[model samples]
Target: MYHEQHGAPAVAPLAGFTVGVTAARRADELGALLQRRGAAVLHAPALRIVPLADDGELLAATKELIDNPPDVVVATTAIGFRGWVEAADGWGFGEELLACLRGVELLARGPKVKGAIRAAGLTEEWSPTSESMAEVLDRLLDEGVADRRVALQLHGEPLPGFVEALRAGGAEVVVVPVYRWMPPEDLAPLDRLLDATVGRSLDAVTFTSAPAAASLFSRAEDRGMLPQLLDALAHDVLPACVGPVTALPLQAVGLDTVQP
Candidate 1:
């Protein structure tokens, strides 16, 4: 196993290093890969999946829509839509849910999501050039969303900010968060990983998503260990991000990310 130096101009694998894995439910998937590659794995799930509120609001929204479906739906994630479909089923509105969007304005966010939509037997009415949310927002804005009834099937945490933005543009947004991304309610297990990183005990850390990186640093910051962890990552430890989004926040901390 070779050691990697910071800004070394390579995205090589660290075979003999210990890394903090920050995937949510798929931590094991990543952990298994790291183990197979000969890296000591620190299983730290920076995100947890939470179902949306079971409030009757969604049911009422479904009933009203079934009786009188709307003009468009902004299905940001296909995974979220499946959950929405299942949730609506228990409420006995799955057919209503599908029928409502049979031939209305439909916008897909990303290929991953679009794949899910297609597998669910739905075709795209409109697809964006990019997978970013802001881009999707721009598309909707350009087309004029004022007084438009748009349903948001969000998978992440509260985007009240997004809601406000849509409202500002005159879109009547009704949201159903199929899932949420949250830190481990208990950080006890991560304490060891944090200690190893802060004490310079780890050789590297791998981040799978932007939120994973953000959550780790934010928690370290809140616990007064940000300096140590940041130092370890930038000067002594290697940081690998799965994609561009995960790499963005790494730059703010003065460390560039290596994607593998």
Candidate 2:
């Protein structure tokens, strides 16, 4: 109708703009969303999600928990929690793991984690509505973790200071590494994205996770373009993140972001 009235179609908000996507999972979906807004999307996954199913580390941790049975179990993310159970299921100990967790004080970091726990036929003793690991940590400290065995299910990378703080409080913390964040096997696309970023060719870059942001910065540093990349991001390129957590890496380097 507007086109009919004006003899031309409305201009898309993102028309003539280029955006770089750095997500490994659901990258196509994100790129599609950006493209729908008329943005020229450049997809370069900064990192890859490596599941630890065959890595033996996850099995070892699962076995340790089954044998030792931690006093408190903290589920940090829905996918991580689900992946742990799925991996255990593949190893023929899913039910055993659930039974062990049933006896401990289970804690969920947010609603999604709570859903995963419930889906696994278990219930959380408590969950923070704020969806914050910090809040969960504070509660654990307040409840006194001295001499307590706590099993923390990590999503990808370690939560900054969380394990250290728990250990400092005399809690025997067993880290369950369900998955890992590794640099993408193919670095060519990432290199191209970095070049575009440093050249100020891209209008914006999207980060879905903190690891992706960190990986991008690491790559830039490795190529000796950190300063130039930082300058471009600071002045010309817009860094957009899914949430505050995903923005941590960018913020750590003294850069601001647009969270949507």
Candidate 3:
């Protein structure tokens, strides 16, 4: 039973619950949302988003792609696409890059990626309903990528295997990494989150990206607490993700997840 105070409703649904947030870009916004629902928030950004401007390799890759446009271009993530465009603009090659992309057959992973491509004054020739990178590769392979030049705008993590798959299909693949995910500079916060998780002090953990989740798992493995952490998450702490893609890693470990 609960009682109201000062005309306010008693016991907000999330009262007495603690939720962990692992988003670097919008961590504060997510924390605020959880707080409004009466939950105590714990933020531990497992991975930090490094912009293309700061990554020399990524900048050079973008330049190479702009200089030599591929026959097909695959845009994976909205933020990654936006970052690539912004970086090229900063380098005084925005127009040239856009023009190059316009000449290529563009493929988007999903609506967000399609929106980013369209926003850049370019159009996507194809997009899959499943919105998965595997699906994107499958469609391209189905269309016969032999002897075609394909450029892929990589998201925050590496996709060497995906590149290999394309290469095996007889396509010359050029990977343009727009951004990357690095472990947080400060590991103290993440350590605390792991402690809480293992102690069953958290009610739920929210992951916005697959890399972040993978980073957390890697860190736990390093500390020899991977089994404990996984057990806690499975039995006590509810794991939540923003989408299926982010849930893939957790699902691989036979852990159930909640996602919108």
Candidate 4:
């Protein structure tokens, strides 16, 4: 299929598919893009966003970093680290956090994390070739973690195995939980989305983030709808992803994907 964009036609494979859009925010861009291609959209934002509250946890984490200043600061996501640092700034310790950053090498997970690290005014010592957590652990361990202090800003649901591996490598790992991804507090819309997908009413199901896909599946499974939902998404439903990273776990679960 081909698309005409800004007066120039684009040869695209996905010119007429009713793709899903699941980005956390600023979704209108992708949604509009898909609409122009003569495809219907389903806006089932599976992940809920919550800004940090009660600065105590962040303050504690920052003080711990400043006092001990981890040998490696592993940032998993750009948005998360920026939010963490901004909250730290609000606490009047922005410079102190930057001072602590200067004492340690930086390891970012993906380009997003790399951008966040640069946003913090630090240079990257290393980052994973892939955004996947497994790759990040492999690279950091290769470098050496023995008796080193490492701080991790968790992205979603905590990568325990990665944390466990670093701990096993004898690194004192401290964590900063900037945000969490969970099911919508109300299950009505999600419940409806699940039924629609399972019933083959949705034209496509696009996921911008893994947690959104995860949230849907988790809820469906709890309600005994996993197998059905998965089957529907695999066959009649289209699974579109914004990028390779967003496509990871969905592919892990056998969902065919169309990438933008």
Candidate 5:
């Protein structure tokens, strides 16, 4: 442990630094944490998590899946799984849906999905170490999906290739998109964040999810500021991510990110 030569008073490590938060869920909590550490937080949620626009289609699909339970069920995200179950319960088919899932071979993409399944009194028979959809699909393919009925809970975004792969394997795939991520209706805050980032005013930007980072980059592209934004992220400002999955897009583009 090293100490100052003159026994200087202690101070917040992040004092005078400004951090940008691009998280939707728990954005306030993150802001509070940074504030407490003496960082000025700039909050600009690039994406807003909204309920599916058309619940009728999802509910009907759930009912059909329950009526003729799929041979395999893939749980992608905890939020999507919980939303699907809760929606079924709202439509009075919760117990039936749970029973149907109980009879199927359950596969989770990650610990979150596994936990969600367990919370619903269901068991997960398989999950991948990477906790990625691609990994989950690979495992399913290796196990043989020919003539199997597979139900997948999507994480809002469309996975056309994944579905195509399953279909090519002779599996009937039913996709359940429980929620969709919509860009922030007001672009003013995001615009401010973009300007500040490029101007080197923000010390760091924290991203909790990949979609949020993508959304921000998409906006910057639309404004023709993507190059400057990337430069800032790569050189001037520190880019932090919650996990590797969330840092994938940033890293792919040659932007180094700090991740826990």
Candidate 6:
């Protein structure tokens, strides 16, 4: 199909499609990619990334780590790891933290985190190629975590069964809570997107993270439109996810999703 709009051709693969984006980080880049394919982009950030309070638990954790460095450090996400280091820098313990980390066995969840570790003048002893935390846990267990001090860097939410498993192995697990996800301060755009989804005005919705998916569901329930939203998502609108982890929230509710 071809349409002439202001002397331009709308013959792209996604022409005539309107896609909804719910990612807060890199939303502009994702939106531009969809638009380049001729799809009308509806940008609605479902959640916002908020760093934890400066003088709160993060500072306490940093001080404790400096006083008692862990035997092993697991860096999960690149951004979260960097944020932790930068936050420590703000507290005037950046060099001390770096020196402490240099003495521990560092494990990066994936390449991005490995880069973050290396960028901080540290090297990772190991990293999983599949980028699965399960693999990292397995390595830790197989190598023996008993009687070891392990520090885990959290991205947003706690990893289910991760800390529990470490504790079960008799390892002292210290969770480094970094950034967290909160509902966007401006809900107008999200409200509009919700309305469009229920009205069948959106052809597809893209999810980059599980929290965004869950936040959308929570907002729909708050408005008492859960059934309507679920019906539209189940029948009319296509749900596109970036990866399997991001698809978990949708899958848990029996919603089919495409990863592309």
Better of 2 and 6 by lDDT: 2
Q: Cα lDDT of all candidates, in order?
A: 0.74, 0.92, 0.88, 0.78, 0.87, 0.91
- Which digits, one per residue and each the tens of the lDDT, describe model 2 over residues 114-136? 99999999999999877878899
lDDT of 4 by residue, 83-106 (tens): 888888888888998888877888
**Of candidates 5 and 3, the better by TM-score:** 3
TM-score of each: 0.76, 0.94, 0.90, 0.82, 0.85, 0.88
Better of 2 and 3 by lDDT: 2
Between which residue pairs do clashes occur in model 1? none
RMSD, every candidate, angstroms? 5.5, 1.9, 2.7, 3.8, 3.2, 3.2
Best candidate per lDDT, number?
A: 2
The parts of candidate 2 lying over 4 Å away from their true place are 1-8
Which 10 residues in a row give candidate 2 its minimum summed lDDT? Answer: 1-10
Candidate 1 per-residue lDDT over residues 5-106, each given as its tens digit: 785544336566788877775788888888767778887777676654464655666676677666677787667777777778877777767878786787
lDDT of 3 by residue, 1-260 (tens): 25689987587778899999988888999999889878999999998878677888787887788777799999989988988899989988899899999888999999989999989889999998877788888888899889999998887765536788889999999888777889999999999999999999999999998888899999999999999999998999999999877887898788999998
Residue pairs in steric clash, candidate 2? none
Cα lDDT of candidate 4 equals 0.78
The top-ranked prediction according to TM-score is 2
Kindly list the per-residue Cα lDDT of model 6 for residues 1-260, writing each as its tens digit. 57799999668899899999999989999999988888999999999887655437788888899999999999998988999999998888999999999999999999999999999999999999978889999999999999999999987667768899999999999998887788999999999999999999999999998889999999999999889998999999999999876887898899999995
In TM-score terms, candidate 4 sits at 0.82
Instruction: Estimate candidate 2's alpha-carbon lDDT, on a 0 to 1 scale.
Output: 0.92
